[model samples]
Every structure is written in structure tokens, then in C-alpha cells.
Target: MSENRLTNILVPVFAVILGIIAGAIVMIVSGYDPIAGYSALLYGAFGDRYYIGETIRQVTPYILAGLAVAFAFRTGLFNIGVEGQLIVGWLAAVWVGVAFELPKVIHLPLAIIAAGAAGALWGFIPGFLKARFRVHEVIVTIMMNYIALYVSNAVIRSVLSDQGFKSEKIHPSASLRSEFLQSLTDYSTLHYGIIISLIAAVVMWFLLEKTTTGYELRAVGFNQHASHYAGMNVNRNIILAMVISGAFAGIAGAMEGLGTFENVSVKAGFTGVGFDGIAVALLGGNHAFGIILAAVLFGALKVGALEMPSAADVPTELVDIVIALIIFFVASSYLIRLVLTRFKKEGK
Candidate 1:
């Protein structure tokens, strides 16, 4: 690999290693056995077919959520409202799935599309305000999160309150469940939603790397004044980027609504997936393939953490500390690069 490529790959790997080392030190200080803890973690993640499937299932939404954040990041935006967008998207998809009566061919796709549309519409507002009024997107998106949360709760209770705080189960026609796949994994919730997430990743890669619009978005992101001087419509691109980013987050919610949960409930607070996505994006360097790897790693850590308390007598919160450290190292890429550069110079 070229030096830059090597750096890109090594930086994240180095961060992960550092995080594990830090976690190990903490474990030792707390009188826990780090080796046993790590061993149990590995066993929980991949020692069985069921665990493997569950790990994949958990990571599926992280991929989309990470992409949502990364897409916005690519276009000079920080879509902090991904949590709110995801909530609305889940509500929209479930609403469509339960309300519609079309054939599977039409119904399933419609529900997914509806979720994306809801997210896009949600994202567009902040983008429009940023483009037109020069309002900061972060502030607007933060406000939108609460609005989406309360509005969704009220709408669900008013319309789909057959259950106490949740909506009715969605129609089978719109479900992404796969009996064959479930059977293969010994009845885990691993569904065809993974296929959608993978396809979306590929699509994201193609769009960003090979398309003119993608180039324009990146250009504006890197230098909005320069892009404007080049005759690119910076404002339009900003809105488009946010809309697309929100659409990705919406589909992530679809995975939960149509595949894992099969129903929508009133959320007590923001789903941590969107917030976790920020970490994933940072760790993955905002690249499509990197995002996939980061999501799987995160998924494995999450599933594996459950086993830590019982198997190794270690608190599951240790895994959270490791994750935070990893994110910290990833975010401080400049430090890692400086160390590498220093080593290279000394070697020369």
C-alpha cells in the first residue's frame, strides 16, 4: 500500500490496540483478569453460530447510522439529529408497513422508501435553514431531535395505540425477516436487512468515489467559498447532502422496525445507535468499507460485553471504557500520524 493508505489503515488498528491495552490495565487495577475477560469476549462473539449471527444483527444498524453520519461529514455537515431522524424513520416505516395492503414486492419496498423519505424531510429543514439563513446546522438539528421525539410519541399514541406505548406489529408483507437465514443461525434475529445494509454501503462507495455530484459535495465541504467561486451551488449541495444523509439513517431505523423489533414503541430517550454511529464514523475514517469493519467491531464488542460479567467476573462497563478510548485515539489521528512520521524520519 502507498504510505497514505498504510497510514490510514494503521491508525485505526493502532487505536484499537491501544484501547485494548488501556482496558487491560484498567482490568488489572480493578482486580479483574484481563486475559480471561478478553477470552470470554472472543468466545461470546464468535464461539457459536448464534452469537455470530447476533453480532451481525447488532452491527447492521450501526452500518447505516455510521453512514448517515459519515455522509454528512463528507459534505461539511454534522448531522447530530440522526437519532431523531432514525426515530421518525422507524415510525414512518412501521406506519406504512401496518397501513399498506400491497403485495410483498410492492409493500416491502414502499415501507423502506417511506422511512427514507421521512428522514430526508427531517434533514432538509436544518439544511435549508443553514443554506438560506446561515443558521448553524448543529443547533437546528439538536432542536429537531426533541421535536421528532415528542411528535412521534404523540402521533403513535393517538393513532396506533392498540398497545400501551407501542404500535401494532407490522404486516408480514413488509417484514424483512428471513426464516431460512434465521434457521441457519439457529433462530437469531439476523435478517435480510443485512443485505440491504451491505448494498447501501456499496452504493455509498460508488456514489462518493465515482459520481460528479459526489465530487461537488466534497468540494463544497472542503472549501465552500472555493466551490462557490467555481460556480458550484454550495447551498444546494449542502441541502442535498443532509437529505441523503438522513435517508441513510432512516433505512437504519427500518432495519430495527421491520426486522428486529417487528413493532414500534415509544422511545424513552434517543436510541444509542445514532450516537454510537458517531464513534463508528470516527473510527472508520468516514470511509464506506471502514464503516462496515468498525460497525462489526462495535457489534462484536457489544454482544461480547454481555458475557463478560458472568464469564470473567468483570463488569460489562469495561467494554464501554475500551470503546471510548478507541474513539479518543481515533479522533486524535494527528497524534498517531505525528508518531509515525517521527519514526519514519528516524528510520531514514
Candidate 2:
């Protein structure tokens, strides 16, 4: 058990280290100061209170998005529709925010719940198809993504438009603001979403590791044939897994709309968060705690990329190159295992 635990931790750590080393080599070949670039990246993400708050803000969506992918992965499903689910969640939350007039106590939670429900419904389509028709979830999810994008844009233009490419601002009552924190850090948009994310992590961990339903889901994931032979309802579990995953992605969208953007707009492009979540889920080993750690790392990279070019004269795109390399290294873990085994044999 200890060896397994050590291997689990070392895999991601070594992958990240190798990725950074590869990134440094690329930077040197490109005539850039790798040390300075990395220094700027670090400072930009954690140099001061403002950057810390921004990092937290960026991490909010990543947490939920990572959870979305990780949850589906646990059930042996690939949820490529998280991008669409996120968009629909944003639309639902913003629509509720503008269409209703209620007290703060009722309005905010209502909008958030509605957003999650919308996302779950979107996820249900592919889930139902897969359960009933043996459809490939990958193809169905990819198609659903495009459908969600176009349909969401149409809704914004035709029904939800407010004389612009955006919806009306959410009512102040429903806004997730932090006036106390604002007085301390000059009014950053970081709010109570961090708390939501932390709570979600705990809840997911409990649900997956400490519940009968979670055991059934994992049994189905490990061997659907065996699960069915043992009398577990595999089809229902599949549908439920996708719906739960979509609900998490929907919460990510709700956080972005209500806590960050405060409104919905005609998205000129996909958020791409759903796709990123795949990499996050893989890097984190699809564990809830691991996902949170992975999300924070990715969030730091994103926040730091903005300041790298301006502060250190490195191209912002360098961060993208580094992230890509990290993903590649993680996906190709066989190389790392080979190296580790060689070292162990030599030491012995």
C-alpha cells in the first residue's frame, strides 16, 4: 500500500518536473531567459494579495470543471459535452438572474440550482442514448457540444438579448459579492465561490468513497459485465453518472456567470474549460483531492501567463507550450515507469 501510494504521488510530480525541464530547453533554444520567465510566472501568480485573489478566482471554475471530468472518468465514461453543459448552465443561470425578482436569500441559490439542472438535462441526452441504443458516448458528446454552442448563441440573439450581444446584468440581490474582502484587496471579483469549491470537494470525496451508490458505480466502471452478472443496473448507473458529471460542469458555468461575469453573452467561442478538465482529471488521477490540487496548478499557470509577457518579456504562449508538454508527459507515463524501474534495479 505504501509503495502504491508513493508511486501515485511521484508520477504526477515527476511528470511536472520533466515538463518544466523540457519547457526550459525550448525557452533556451528560442533565445529567451528561462529563469526570468519562470520567475515572472511565479510572482504573477503569488506575488501579492491581488494575484492570490485572482488565482483563487480562476481556480473556482477549474474545480468544478475538473470534478465534472473526474466523476465521469470514475464511471468509465468520457464526458466530452462538458463545454456544452457549461454554456447551457451559464445561460440558465443568467436567464434566471434577470427574469426573476426575489430576495437575495432565494434568488442566488435558485439561479445556481437552475443552472445545474439545465446542465444535467443536457448531459441526459447522450446518457439516455447510450443507455438505450448502445451509442458511443464520445461521438454523441462531441455532437452535443456543437449543438449546445449554436443553440445557446441563438437563444442569446433571439430571446435573451438586451439590445446588445449580452444579457442584462444580474440583479444586485443575486450577485455573489465580497464587500469585506473588497475593502481589504481593492474589490476583486473573488467571492464565496472558493467556499463552494472546497465544500464540493469534500462532498465528492464522501460520495465516491463512502457510499453504496459510489461502490456500485465503481463496480460498473471496473467491469460492466461482472456488475450486470451480479444484478447491478448498469444502464441506470451510466445515465446517473453522466447526469452527475454534467451537474458539476453546470456549477462551474454558474460560478463564472454569477460570480465572475455577472451576465450571459453571445459567446464568440467555446470556453474550452470542459476540454481542459480532461487533462486536469488525468493529471490528478481522477481523485477529488487530487483534482483540487491539479486545478490550482492549472489556475496558477493561467493567471501567470497573463503577466509573463508584460513583466518578463516572455511570450504568453510559452505557458501553453509548457502545459501541452505536461499533458503529453502525463499521458505517456510508461516512460516514467521505465526510468523508475531502471533506477530501482541499479540501486538494488
Candidate 3:
């Protein structure tokens, strides 16, 4: 492999190892057996076919959410409002799914399209602000997230209030469930959403690798002034990138509505998945395949954590600490390498 490829692969792998080691140290200090804790965690996530399927199910939305953040990052925009866009998309998908009486083929695609459109609209706001007014995207997206939460909840309450905090269940035609897959995994919630996530990853890779539009967006991201001087439409690409990113995020929300939860619920704050996407994007180095692997790691961590306390007397929160340490190590990889070099020199 080329040097850049080697670095990309090794950096994350080393970070993961360091994080696990640190977590083990913490476990030892707290008088827990690290081996038992980790063994239980691994078992919890994959000991049974059902557990393995559930881990994949949990990862489905995360892949799309990470894609949303990764896409925006590649295009020189920080889209922190994915949570808000996701909320609106969830509401839109659920509304369409519940209202439509169409056939399965038409209904499912229509609800998904509505979700994407809703997310795109939310993304457009921040993109427009950045392009037209030179406003920073991060602030705008953060504010928009709460706006989305409150507005969506108010709308759901006004219309579907009888359901008490959740919208009506979507029609079977609009659902993403797959009985075959469920049975294969002994009745896990693993659904067609994973298919969607895989398709989205392929699309993202093809777009970024094989398209002139992707090149222009990347050029603009590298240097907007240079791109504009070279006759590229910088402002247009900015808006387009956000729209596409938000569409990915919206589709993630659709997974939750149609696959996992089957309904939309009123929430007081952001969905944790959006924030998790940031970490996933970072750990994945903003690559499509990398994001999938990162999402799987996170999914395993989340699922495995549930069994830690009962099986090994380890707190579930320790997993979060490990994740945070991993992020810290990844971000500080240069320092890590320097320290390793020093140790090698001393050994010599």
C-alpha cells in the first residue's frame, strides 16, 4: 500500500488499541477484571445470532448519520444540525407513511423521498446563510437543531396528540422490515435499512471518486477563492453539498421511523445519533467504507455495554470513557508517534 493508505489504516487501528489498553488499566484500578469485562462485552454483542443481528441493526442509522457529517466535512462545511434535520425528516417520513394508502412500492419510496426533502430543506438554510451572508455554518446548524426539535414536536402534538408523544404507526406498505432477515437472525430488528445504508455508502463512494461535480466540490472545499477564480460556482456547490448531506441524515431518520421505532416520538433534545456521527466520521477518516467499519465498532460498543455491569461488574459508562479516549488518541496521533519514536530510540 501507498504511504498515505498505510497511515490512514494504522492511525485508527493504533488508536483503538490504545483506547482498549487505557480502558483495561481503568478496569484494573477499579478492581474489575479487564479480561472478564471485555469478554462479556464481546459476548454480549456477538455471542448469539440474534445479538449479532441486533448490532447490525443498531449500526444502520449510524452509517447514514456519519455519511451526512462526512459529506459536509469533505465539502468544507460543518453541519452540526444533522440532529435537527433528522428530526424533521423523521416527522415527514412518519407523516407520509401514515397518511398514504398507496401500494407498497409507491408508498415506501414516497415516504423516504419526503424524509430526504425535509432534511434538504433544513440543510439549505445553513448553506444559504454561509454562502450569502458569510455566516458560520456551525452556529446556524446548532441553533436550527433545537428549532427542529420544538417545531416538530409542536406539529406532532397538534395533529397526532391523541397518540401521546408519538405519531401513529406507519402503514405496513411503508415499513422497511424484512421478515426473511428477521427470521434469519431469530427475530432481530435488522431490516431493509441496512440495505439502504449499504446503497448510500456505495453512492457516496462513486460520487466522490468518479464524478466531476465531486471534484469541483472538493476543489471549493480546499480553497473557495481559487475555485471561484477558476470559474467554479463556489456558492452553488456549498448549497448542493449541504443539501446532499442533509438528505443522507434525513434518510437515517427514515430508518428509525420505518425500521426501528415504526413511529415518531416527541423529544426534548437532540437525538444522540447525530453527535455520535461526528465521532464516527472522524474515526473513519471521512471515507465511506471507513465510516461503515467505524459504525460497526460503535454499535458493538453500545450493545456490549449493556452486558458489562451484570456480567463483569463494570459500569456501562466505562464504554463511553473508552470511546472518548479513542477519539482523543486519534486526534493526537502525531504526539503518539513522537512518543513511540522516543521509546524506540531509547531501546536502541
Q: Using TM-score, give the best candidate's number.
A: 1
Which is the winner by lDDT between candidate 1 and candidate 2?
A: 1
What TM-score would candidate 1 get against the native? 0.98
- Give a tens-digit lDDT track for model 2, residues 45-124: 88888888888888888888889888888989999989889999988988899899999999999988998998999889
The digit string of per-residue lDDT tens for model 1 on 1-348 reads: 599899999999999999999999999999999999999999888879999989999999999999999999999999998888898899999999888889999999999999999999999999999999999999999999899999989888888784369999999999999889889899989888899999989988898889999999999989999999999999999999999999999999999999999889988888889889889988989999999999999999999999999999999999999999999888887899999989999999
Span of 10 residues, lowest total lDDT, candidate 2: 180-189
Candidate 3 C-alpha lDDT tens digits along 119-220: 999999999999999999999999999999999999888886674788889999999988898899899888899989989999998887789999988888
TM-score of each: 0.98, 0.97, 0.96
Q: What does the lDDT read for residue 81 in candidate 1?
A: 86
- Computed on alpha carbons, the lDDT of every model, listed in order, comes to 0.92, 0.87, 0.90
After TM-score superposition, the amount by which residue 316's alpha carbon in candidate 1 deviates from its true location, in angstroms, is 1.4
Clashing pairs in 2: none
Cα displacement (Å) at residue 118, model 1:
0.7
Residue 275, model 3: lDDT of 86
Off by over 4 Å in 1: none
Rank by TM-score, highest first. Answer: 1, 2, 3
Q: For candidate 1, list the clashing residue pairs, or say none.
A: none
Off by over 4 Å in 2: none
